[model samples]
Target: MAFALQGRDQSLVALGCRKRYIRGPRRADALVGASGPAGSGRPHQSGTQQQRQQKQPLLAEQLWFDEERILVDESFEAAEGAQLSPHLKVAKHVGSGTSADVYKLQGDGKQPELVLKMAKPVPGLRRAFQREWMLGRRLNAVAAAASELNMIIHTGPAVVSEDKKGQLVFRGTVLEGINGKSLDSRLEKDASFCDVDFIMMMLQQVLTALHKAEALVGFQHGDLRISNIMEHSTDPEALQALRDDAQTWQAQGFVSAESAALAKGLLTFKILDFGHSKINERQARSYLKLSSPNMNTPADSAPAGSSSGSSSSSSSSSSLALQRLPAAKGPLEAFYSFWYRGRSDSWRLLRSLATRLDGR
Candidate 1:
C-alpha cells in the first residue's frame, strides 16, 4: 500500500518501497502516511487517517515528532502548570544560575520530590550538563547495588527532552528532600565547629564518599564546599548540646571539656551537588572557566586576583590567567589534589583531638 497527503502549503508522499514519508515545513504538523498496493482506495479513507483522528495530542503540548525525530524549539519555556507526563507536574522555578535553572516539581506521591534541571542550551555547555546526567545515571545504578553511602543522594535515570521552544533539556532522578541544614549555615551559627572533633568525623565521612568516587568510580567532584554538605542530626538532645556548646564557647571563650567532646562526637554529614563532576578519562578543563559567583574557593587555595575595575577587563584578565595555569594530568590527579587538600586539614584536627583526649 502507498499513501500521500497534500496540505494547504506542503505535500507528503509515502512510498511503500522506501517505507518512509517526507516531512515538510516547520509550521506543518506531520502528515504521516504509509503506502501499500498500487490500487489503494481514496487516501482519505485509509486507516492512517482514522488513526490520526483517533490519536490524542501530545502530553507535552509543545513537543512533536517529525521525520521520526523529536523536534523542540529552544525559545519556548514550559508554561505555568504544564504537565510533562501524567504523573509529573512542573511547578515554579526553585533555583536558577547562569548555567541552568532547577524547577521544583511533583511526581506521583509514590516517588520522591523531583528537581528538574533545565540547562540553558548554550552551544558548548550542553556537554557538561549531559556528562553530569551520565554520571548521575551511573551512580544511580551503582547505588542500587551498594547501600554503604547515604551521603550521595539517589539520582534516577536521566531523561532528555525538549522544552516548549524546542530547546533540549535534561531531567534526572527525583531527589529526596533532605531535612538537615547546610554546613555553611550551621557553621555561620556555630563557628566553634571549626575546633570540634565531631566536625572532623563529619569531614571524614565526606572524604570517604569522595574516596569511593575516586578509587572505585574514577570520578572527581570538581566542586566541594561547605554549602554542598548537609548535616542530619538524629538526636535532638545531641543537636541541642552542640548548640549549647557553641553558645557557651562564644560567650565564655570555651566550653566544658565533656560537652565540647560530646558535641564533636555527634556530628552528621551528607554531600550534595555533582554538577561539576568529571569522569576518569574526560577533559574537564572547561569547568574552571565556568565559575559561579557564589561558589566557594578552597580554604587553602590562593585567593583570586582582583579585577581591574571594569567587568569586561577583569573577565578577560581572569580568563587569560586561568589559561596560563597548568592543567592536572588526569582525573585521578585532580581528585587527589582537591580531596587531599580538604582531607589533610580534617586529619590534622582528628589527630590533634585524639592527642588531647589522651589517645582516645
Candidate 2:
C-alpha cells in the first residue's frame, strides 16, 4: 500500500475494519466542555465512585459509533440550534462508493472545487458522512496546533441535511476539496516522489500529521490505503524547523530513526476519506459505562449474531436499528471488539513506504 491521497478507503483485514460504509452524521469529535465523567465506561484508574471525579466529560458523539448517531439527529440539531446547510446546489456526480455518492459543487471562484458528499437513507449512510466531517476537523485541529501543518486544508464539519427526492431520500455533506488524484496516479502521471529526499519529506509530513490526529482525538484511520493520503502543504517555518532541527521532531517521537532526514522543498500530506476509521483503543476504553461494553465480560463484547440476547433486534426504538455495534468494552472500544486489534498507524506508514524500497 502506497501513501496515496483522496481518502478512498481500503480493506484493513488485520483490524477487521470494513471498506464499505453507509452515510450519516457523527457527534464523535464534539467536545462536551471537558467536565465530569462522560460517554460510556469508567476511567483507567481503579475507582468505584470517589476517584472517578471530573476526569472524563460526557461526549455524546462517541455514542454515534455504537448507536449510529441515534442519540442525536436532525431534530437533535434543531433543539440544540445547530446550523444546517440545506438545499445545496450540486454541479455533478463525480463518483460513487459502497454506501455514499461523491459530487462536485460549483464554487464561486473564490473557493472553487468544493465536494458535496452524499449518502442514501440506509443504515450506515449518516455514519459515513459524519465520519469524514468530524474526523476531518480532528485532523485540521492537529494541523492548527502545529505551525508547520497550518497551511493545508483537511475539511470542515459535515453540514448534512435531509432532502426529498421522493420521501426524504437524499442526504449529503459539504467538504473542502482535497485537490489531486491518488499517489499511484500522481506517480504514473509524474514522478515527483521517486527521490529519497521527496520520500523523506513525505515521511515527515505524514508522520507528524498522523501523530497529531492520534494524540489529540484518539482517531485511527484503520483503512490506511495509499489513496487515503494526498499532497498537502506545510508552512515554510515548520518545514524549515524539521530540516534544521530534525533532532527535535525525533525527540518528540513523531518520526522513526530511519526517516530523520528532510527534503529541500516543502511536502505535506493529510489522511482523507475516512470512510473506514474508528476511535483508538485507549480513548475508546474511556467510555466504559454500564450500558457500554465490558472487556471482562465476553458476552457484553459479543457481536450481534453471537450475543445470546438479540438486544439489537429485539429493541423497539428505531434508534436501535441504526445502532451498529451492541457493546463497547471501553469508550470507543464499544465500537471495537474484545479481540486482538492493531494501533500501529506509524508502523504501517513505514511498512507502506517500504514498497518504494523493493529490490533495493
Candidate 3:
C-alpha cells in the first residue's frame, strides 16, 4: 500500500510522503484521520535551500586594464599621484622563464629604477608563478629577520594584478639596479678573486645568508650556484685593513699570502632565486633522490610489449633495484638537475667564475 505524508497546519500535499505527526505505520491511521489530504495539511519544509546557500564557493577578484592607450595600466595609474611612483619604462628584458619575463625597467622622470617582472598565464607554469608569489609573501613576512641578520638585501612590496589580457601579473619587490659587474663576470675578467681566503669569506657570507633564511623561514636556498651572486667594490680603507690582517696572518703561518689577499678583496655576495627551495624535510628527500640516479628511472622502462619482468624483478630485489640508480655526476649538476635544472645556466656561469677565480 502507498502511504501519503503531510504537515499538520498548512494544506501542503505530500504524495507518498510520511506525515510529521505519525510515528510509524501504527500511528498512520490516527494521523490520516486528523489531517486529511483535502486542505488540513501544513507546508512541506526541507533544508535543501539553506544547505545550498551555505555551500557556495568564494571567488578571487578579477582585474582588467587597457595596454595600448595607457602608458601605464589602470591599477598602476591609480598609484600615479602617490609619492611612490609605480610607472616604469621597460628598458630591456633581463630574463625570461616558462611563465614570466623579467625586464630591467627605468622609472619615469625621477623615480628610482626598478625591475618589472611580467607574468604570463601558462597551464604548466601557473604553479611556478603561484609558488613564487608564496615565496615572495614569505620573504616579506621575514623582511625584518633579514635586516637583523644583515643578509644581502631584503625584497620590497610585491604587487599582483591583472594585465590587458586579464592574465595574472606581478610587480614591486624592485631589486635596486646596481651599477657593477656580476661576481661571475668579475671573476672571469680578473683572476685576483681566486685567493683561498677570499673564496672562504664569500662562501661564509653565502652560508650566513642561508642560515638566516633557515632560521627565519625554515628553508635554505635549494639552488645556491654562483651566477646569482653579484659583487660590489669595497671601501679602500676596508680593503687595506683586510690586506693588513692577511699579512699578519701570513706572518703567523696561519694562512698563505695569496689566500689572505683574496679574502681581503672579498666584497659582497647575494643569493637569489627561491623557486626550487623546499622545507627542511622535503629538501632532505629531494637531495637523496637527486644524489641517486637509480631512484629517478622508471620501473616500467622494460620494452613496452615485454612481460613485466623488470618490474617483477625490481619488486623482488629491492636492494638490487636501489643499486641500479647511478651516482650524481657532480654536486652542482646534481643540485641543479634535481631541483633547479631549467635555471642551470646561472649555476654554470657561477661555476665558471669559481674556476677562473681559482686559476688566478
Best by lDDT: 1
Q: Who wins the TM-score comparison?
A: 2
| Model 3: lowest-lDDT 10 consecutive positions | 59-68
State every prediction's TM-score relative to the real structure.
0.46, 0.46, 0.43
The residue ranges of model 2 lying beyond 4 angstroms of the native Cα positions read 1-88, 109-112, 148-153, 162-170, 187-193, 233-267, 279-340
- Relative to the true structure, how large is the alpha-carbon lDDT of every model? 0.41, 0.40, 0.38
lDDT of 1 by residue, 1-360 (tens): 222222221332221222222221121112222222222222222454344424422111111111111122334354457664456666777767887776776777744445566667666455555455445544443333332233565444333444444333443333444446786675466433333333434444565555444544455565566666776543446556657665653453332322232233333455666665555432222232222222233323321222222222212222211222223344545665665554432243233333333211
Candidate 3 collision pairs: 5-17, 5-18, 7-42, 10-41, 10-42, 194-357, 198-262, 198-263, 294-325, 294-326
* Clash number for each model: 14, 33, 10
- Candidate 1: where are CA atoms >4 Å away? 1-80, 162-176, 189-197, 232-268, 281-360
Q: Compute the lDDT of residue 104 as modeled in candidate 1.
A: 71
Q: What TM-score should be assigned to candidate 2?
A: 0.46
Candidate 2 per-residue lDDT, tens place, 30-121, comes to 11111123221221222322222232211222212332211113332221123233323456667777766676666435343466555655
